[model samples]
Target: MYLVGLTGGIASGKSTVSSMLRELGCPIVDADVVARKVVEPRTLAHSRIVFHFGHEILLENGEIDRQKLGRIVFADAEKRKLLNSITHPEIHKEMLKQIIYYFLRGFRYIVLDVPLLFETRKLTHFLNHTVVVYCDPATQLSRLMLRDALTQEEAEQRLAAQMPLNEKRGLASHVIENSASREDTHRQVLRLHTKLEDSMDFLLVRVLAVAATAGLGGVLLYAAKMIFS
Candidate 1:
């Protein structure tokens, strides 16, 4: 199985790439979705967070007030670290479980879409290849402002919180430049899909060749033993 790690800064079009991969039949394990699931009401993460940050972060309906928690944590490094400490492990565990499920089900290629691939540095061990979707700072700011309704400064602050786009591009095994139209991005994704499929075919051939060679060697050894006997 081939595991690809997909990462990019906020509003950098990673979601679009993920969607394209899904449409193309690649199984995806989304970290953000897993993160939310891990912190759902009545979960251990939810309980730990409530205990540490007080009940004020909970709504009257007994669910987490994500906005309130975001306000408290995003602006404070310590609080953000505390939140990550509570959530990251659970998220990682769930992601790994999903990855293993897909792998065992015979998926040749799977994409692990994560926002903080570089920051967490867990991609190195889990991913066979890493793809980073990237755009210029101006394009990122514009898209983020329109999508999230944030001011330029606010968007920039959020962008700054993660690694720079250039750095992510440098670290990635493949970079999808998304500073163009949706059609352009789709073309890039399709190209990437082709490349990944070709690589998978090559890997499969190599594995089959090795197995065949081993089997032939074993058969020859058995024949030699019979003759000697």
Candidate 2:
């Protein structure tokens, strides 16, 4: 299976790109979706989080208040690590299960949309390629400020919490320049999809060839044994 890791800085339009890919019929295993699933009320991860951070983080409905938890973790490195420690393993397990489900259904390739793909560096081994949806720093900051109603300082602090988009672009195997119009971004996604489709074809051929060779060798071995007997 071909695994493509998709990431970008906050407000750099990673979600937009993911939506586009999903519209294009690509199966997306989104980390954010898995994240919410793992932390649902009464789940093991959710229970551990409440125990570690106290009951104050829970909402009236009994769900863990994500915004409250985020405020705690994003403020302190140690807290961030603690949160990751509780959730990452469960997230990984779900991601692997989804990947296997796609493979079983004969998907050619799948997109793993992880916002922290570069930050954790744990996903590198699973990815055959990485794509970064990129915009300039100014554009990124402006978008974040406008989207979240944060002041410049607050936006900068949020940006500071993650790896910069420029550096991520340097590490990416593919880039979608989202500073431009949506049409342009769509074109780039389509181009990438074509490449992925081609790679899928190649992977299928390689798997079939290996199976054919093993089958032929097994048949020859059986014939030789019969002759000898």
Candidate 3:
């Protein structure tokens, strides 16, 4: 199956579009979900995080207090990078597992919902299609403020932390504008789903798998013929 990378600004409704795609039976590998899983109390990443950042970041129950860690990292780029260095490998491993699971199940394509799809640029080359769910800057800032109950300044700081949506829009193969009504957004998602399903891209992986198996079979047959002769 082909891979699709989906991303947007913090409050640009990327998750909403992801949900719509899910309703259409598309498989999704969400980075945010995997990120949370990699840092569970007993995970290796969790131990490393606590060791570096200290137990102060943990809650009374010993789970990492994400908010506390977020505050520390977001305020310092070095700390953020350190946190990523610890968690990213585990996150990638888990995401790869999920992708393989979906691929084996014979999905047409799987959506990878990554907030930093543009920022990280790690998986961009592997994606057959990349989508950016976009909204205007003012709308994004306002939406973030409302959703997170943050002051205008706080929301702006959060927005500035990531690459701008406009830049990501230019980099994407498709753009779904979420600035308008939910109906409009849903229509765009429906069209996108149809487009992805109709593409022949998914056949590439299947063809490669079949060719590899056939090649191995040929090798085995040649060895048997030599032995018999």
TM-scores of all predicted structures: 0.85, 0.87, 0.91
Off by over 4 Å in 1: 200-229
How well is each residue in 1-229 modelled by candidate 1, as lDDT tens digits?
A: 6678899999999999899999999999999889889898989999999999999998898888887887678678898889989998888778777865885587778898999999978556646789999999999999999998878877777777788999999999999999989999999999999888878443753474466587765764454344222
Off by over 4 Å in 3: 215-229
- Cα lDDT tens digits, model 2, 1-229, are 5689999999999999999999999999999999999999979999999999999999999999987887788778899999999998888878877876886687778899999999988877657789999999999999999998888987888898999999999999999999989999999999999898887444753474466587765764454344222
**Pairs that collide, model 3:** none
Residue 184 local lDDT, model 2 = 97
The stretch of ten residues in a row with the least summed lDDT in candidate 3 is 220-229
RMSD of each: 8.9, 8.2, 7.0
lDDT, candidate 3, 23-80, per-residue tens: 9999999999999998998999999999999999999998899877877887788999
Q: Backbone collision count in every prediction?
A: 0, 0, 0
Against the true structure, whose lDDT is highest?
Answer: 3
